[model samples]
Target: MIIIGERINGMFRDIAKAIREENGAVIQDWARKQEERGARYLDINVGPGSTEPVRVMKWLVEETQKASDLPLCLDSTNYDAIEAGLKVCKQPAMINSVPAEAAKMERVFPMAAEYGAEVICLAMSEEGIPKDADSRVALAMELVATADAYNLSPDTLYIDPLVLPCNVAQDHGPEVMETLRQIKLISDPPPKTVVGLSNVSQGTKNRELINRVFAVMAMGNGLDAAIADACDEELMAAVATARILLNIDIYCDSYVDVFMKG
Candidate 1:
């Protein structure tokens, strides 16, 4: 499974401070730490705090690249901010998202194609997040169709089933897993599946435990990637173990150690 580190986002106190202070040290430090902790990509978000988000996005990309070579997942609702980060990113990056909405698809897909970046397609539309797997899959299909029209390959599109907080929407957990399973059948080669894994545990007391269990279960249901806390050692270990059990990784006594090392 691909792990995109969620630590560099400005929503976190440390990251928000770093962005505000223009402190490259903090940003670069987190970038290196996430890379060392087994993140395949670093997600850079200026969050909603920045007034000059485009400039901040470029700064974040530059700072992150200074410490780690891992590609970034440029995350922003602002199209200009995403494009700014894309412009400065030395490696090909991933767009954090475009919804199934036509206006968004028209803008983000072309930008992704131009930059040769992967994209996360959210399985929600203007009507808001669906309450069931079938409705979410319908949006996923529309996302896939729109992306195809812009010449974006299914392999490069990550379909997010939109995991809601389990506490508020307990029934959504199974629905999300079912959506993950069905999303894989949407096309030949299919769009890759991902979830903002932390959302599963949002507002919960035992957040880590919730995230770990849901992550493992989601993998079983065809999750291909996650935007998550890569620095969570126990969580990563659980994921490694689950992957081995699923035959996605070869098992060895030291498999967890080996996986962490990567």
Candidate 2:
């Protein structure tokens, strides 16, 4: 499974303070730590903490790269902010998202193609989040078709089924899993399926337990990647174990140690 570290976002208090204070050390440290904790990519988000999002995004990207070589997932609702970070990225990065909206796709897809970057397509559009697996899959198909139109390969496109908080949307858990399973059948290669893993347990008492269990369950339904809190050791360990059980990893007594060290 691909891990995109979600800890560098300014939504967190420490991260918001770091961004506001222009603390490169804090940002870079989180980047390095997430990479050491087994994240293949770091997600950088300025969130609502910044008044100058574009400039701050550029700074965040540069600071993150100073400590870790992992590619970034430029995450912002602000298009210019995402573009600013992309401009300074030394490696091919990913755009954290584009909803399945026509105008947004027209902008984001070409930019991704030009920068040799990947894209995450949220499985919703102007109408709103769908209530069922079939609707999510239908939106995913439209997203994949749009990416293809822009000459982006299926492998470069990630379809996010948009899992909501299970506390309120209990039935959504199984629906999202079904969406993941069906998404893989959309094409021969299939656009990868991902979810914001933390969303499953938002506001729940057993956050870590819920996250770990849900992550493993999602993998069973063909989840290929996740935006997650890599700092959660138990969650990462669970992912390693799940990978082995699924025959995606060679198991050994030290498998968890080996996976975490990566």
Candidate 3:
């Protein structure tokens, strides 16, 4: 599974403080720890809290690059911030998303293509989050078409079928899984499917339990990646075990080695 480390986001209080203080030391420490723990991409979100996200994002991107060679997932709803982060990125990274809205597609896809960055397209739109599998598939199709028009190959587009909180809607996880399966069925050489794995347990008491169960189910239904807490040992163990069970990795040698170093 493609693990995008989610700890560096500005939504977290400590990280927000670190960013506000321009603490390169704290940011570098987080990046190094995530990389050492086996994260493939480190997700950097300026979030809604920052007034001057572009400036902060540029600094974060540069600092992260200085600390590690692992690619970043430049995350922001602000197009300018996304562009700034992309500019400072040393490697081809992932844009942490565009929704199904036409305006979003127009703004983000061109940048993605120009920078040779992979993209994550959320299965949401101007009409708001879809509640059913069919509507979700329709939104995904629209995103796929938009990417194609920009000459961005399917492999470079990661489709996130927005996993909802199971505590609020018990059927949410199954619906998302069905949507993922449908996307794979429709696309010729389907785009990679991913999720914000923590979304499944939001507002719930047994968060780790919900996250692991939903992750295994999502992987079984063709999920290839996730944005999750790289520091969570239980979640990481679940991810490693799921990969072996799904036959994505042979034997568990790589997984074991990763944990041993941790």
Candidate 4:
């Protein structure tokens, strides 16, 4: 599974403060920690709160690339910020996303294809997030079609099925699995499936427990990646174990090395 560390985002209070204060050391420290924790891509979100997202994102991407060769997931709702980060990135990276909305695709997909950057497509459109599995699958198909029109291969896209909080939706777990299964069925060669695994646990008391359980369940339903806290040793261990059990890893060597090395 591809682990995209979802730390270093301006959404977090401390991280937002760090960026606001131009604390390069704090951001660099996050980059190093995620890399050391086996993250394949470090997700950097210079969110709405940043006064200068383009400048901050560019500096963050450059500084992160200098510290490690691991690719980055440039995260922003702002197209300008995305472009700025892409300009300075040293390796093929991911765009944190484009919604299934038409305007979003028009703005982001062309840039993604032009720069050879992979994209994450959310299974939600301007109509808003789907309430059922079939609608989610339909939105994913729409995203795939949009990418195809740009000559982007399915492998270059990551589909996020928009996992909602279990507190609000009691059947959130099954709905996510159903969406994953439906997406796999729709594509001849399926795009990599991912989710914000922690989202399912939002508003819940037992966050870690719920996150691990949902992560394992999602993997079973063909999820190939996730935006997660890579620094959580136990949660990462659960993911590694699930991957090994699913035969996604051979001999458990990769899993063992990821956990036991320290």
Candidate 5:
């Protein structure tokens, strides 16, 4: 599974203050830490707090690259900010998402193709999050059809089934799994499946346990990547164990240690 480090976003109070203060030390430190924790990509989001998001995005992208050579996932609803980060990124970055909405696709998809970047296509349209597997699949199909215009292949797209808070929707776990199962059958080469795994534990008391179990279950149902807290050793260990059990990794007694060392 591809682990996207989710710690540097401005949504967090510490990161927000660091961004506001132009704290390159904090940004670079966090970037190095995430990379050491085995993140394949670092997700950088200026979020909504930035008064000058374009400048902040540029700084964070540059600072992160200075600390680690890992590719970035530019996360924002603002296309300008995304482009700003993209401009500074050394490699083809991943756009953390474009929804199935037509206007959003028009903005993100073309830029992704133009930059030779990968895209995360949310399985939600303008009408909002679908309640069932069938509806989610419908929206994902729309994005798949649109990908053809930009010459994007299955590998260039990461399809998020839009996992909701399990606390709010009791049946969401099953619904998401069903959506994952069916998403693969729609094409000869399916879009890579990913989840913002933390969303499953939002507002819950036992967040780590819930996230670990959900990661295992989601991987079984076809999830190949996640944006998550890689700093949590226990949670990442659980994921390593699950992957080995699923035969996605070679089994060894010290597999968890080996996985983290990568």
Candidate 6:
């Protein structure tokens, strides 16, 4: 499974302060640490912390690259900040999202094509988050067609089924897994499915346990990647275990160690 590190996002207090102060050391430190913790992409976001998002995004992209060459997941609703971040990114990266809405697809698809970047398409639109599996699948299918029209391969499109806080939307958990399964069956070489895994346990007591359990569950149901807290050892270990069990990784007694060290 692909791990997009969530620690660098400015939603966290430390990250928000770093972004506000343009603290390169703190930002690069998080970037390097996440890379060492087995992240495939470092998700960078200014969130509500940045008053000058475009400038801050450029700084973030450049600063994070100073420590590691890992691709970034440029996360923002601000189109100009996304563009600014992409301009400074040394590698092809992932766009944190576009939704299934027509205007966003028309815009974000072309941007993805131009930058040779992948994108996460939220399985939502003007109707908002669907409460059922079928609606998510329908939105994902539309995203696939939009991707094709832009000449962005299905592989470059990551469809996020959009997990809500499971504590509030208790019954929706299984529905999301079903959505993941349906997303893969949409086409041959299906659009990859990802989730913001931490959202599953937000505001809950057992955040790590819930995140790990839900992550492994989603992996079993054809999840391809996740934007997650890589700093959580149990969470990462669980992912490694799931990968090995699913035969995505070779088995060994030291499998977890090997996966982490690699």
Sorted by TM-score (best first), the order is: 1, 2, 6, 5, 3, 4
In order of appearance, the predictions have TM-scores of: 0.98, 0.98, 0.96, 0.95, 0.97, 0.98
Q: Give a tens-digit lDDT track for model 3, residues 168-187.
A: 87776667889989888767
- Could you give candidate 5's per-residue lDDT for residues 1-262 as a string of tens digits? 7789999899998888888788888989998988887788899999775788888888889988989898999988888989999988899999989999888899998899888899989999878898999999998888998987888987788899988888999787788999998988887788888899899999999999998889889888888889999898988898888889899889988899888767
Candidate 4 weakest ten by summed lDDT? 253-262
Cα displacement (angstroms), candidate 1, residue 255, comes to 0.7
Residue 109's lDDT within candidate 5 is 88
TM-score of candidate 3 relative to the true fold: 0.96
The residue ranges of model 3 lying beyond 4 angstroms of the native Cα positions read 252-254, 259-262
lDDT of 3: 0.87
- Clash count list over all predictions: 0, 0, 0, 0, 0, 0
Clashing pairs in 2: none
lDDT of 6 by residue, 1-262 (tens): 8799988777889988887777899998998888888888999988774789898888989999999889999999987899899888898989989999898888889989999999999999898999999999999999999899999889889999999998899988989999999998887788999999989998999889999999999999999999998878898899999999999999999888777765
lDDT of 5: 0.88
lDDT for each candidate structure: 0.92, 0.92, 0.87, 0.85, 0.88, 0.90
Clashing pairs in 1: none
After aligning candidate 5 to the native by TM-score, how far in Å is the CA of 117 from where it should be?
0.6
Better of 2 and 4 by lDDT: 2
- Off by more than 4 A, model 4: 252-254, 259-262
Give the CA lDDT, 0 to 100, for residue 149 in model 4: 96
lDDT of 1 by residue, 6-38 (tens): 999989999999988999999999999989888
Candidate 6: residue pairs that collide? none
